[model samples]
Target: MKKMPVALMLAATVFAGVATYTVPAQAATNSVVKPELDEGMVKLEVYFSSYPPNNYSDENTGFNGWLVGVTPLPNGQYKGTYYGYMY
Candidate 1:
């Protein structure tokens, strides 16, 4: 009989997750989307910036890459496979 309660709880959790997950898909797709930066390098997206930023300002050029996947190697230098615009 105790198993019945545990089973119901598990079932409820699964249903809750599915219901919450599927509901978001119905929202209207907007313009924000991550392009194919590289082969599995999409995880390197740092930030979102506007084009023609300040007419020609180098500071606000655009969303430069991020240090997302960068890692510290044994050489004490951080390195990672990055794919994006950088100056």
Candidate 2:
């Protein structure tokens, strides 16, 4: 009877080991997106930056400015927040 318990425990251990090895670990990947605007659309040509922004000023002689970051979602849509102000 004791042998039966030992065998069961050994089987359980082996099963657990197999499960751990066979199941692959999954990781999520996130990518950042940058937005572009027509140069003539808005006068804020300078602020149309990429993922890591560098400039936050309008090329034209204007006070309007914008700072934004965009990320693509799994639903095939973009998700992000924006902050616009006049400088």
Candidate 3:
């Protein structure tokens, strides 16, 4: 009985140690770019001169722009809009 408890505790300790082990995180070296527009996809370009209250503007251009892609649904019945911002 004593040996059985000792063996079970040892097995539990080993499992706990393995569960706590983790790989170190790494920093990305390459930048991620958006995918190219496919056929039948619609693109919308938006430019902003000034917002409001604070009147925020892009530091480099004094304005900002966004590119939105609208893709057709898989069912071919509707379209879905996707937007992403990268700074």
Segments of candidate 2 deviating more than 4 angstroms: 1-4, 26-87
User: Which segments of model 1 are wrong by more than 4 Å?
Assistant: 1-4, 25-60, 64-87
Better structure of 1 and 3 per TM-score: 1
Model 3 over residues 19-59: C-alpha lDDT tens digits? 76653111211214345656543333333332211112345
Better-scoring candidate (TM-score), 1 or 2: 1
Whole-model lDDT for model 2 versus the true structure?
Answer: 0.44
* Whole-model lDDT per candidate: 0.41, 0.44, 0.38
Output the TM-score of candidate 1: 0.28
TM-score per candidate, in order?
Answer: 0.28, 0.26, 0.23
lDDT tens readout by residue for model 1, 1-87: 445688899999999988878854214222234356664333332222221111121256443443223334455543332345534
Best by lDDT: 2
Question: Relative to the unseen true structure, what is the Cα RMSD of model 3?
Answer: 15.9
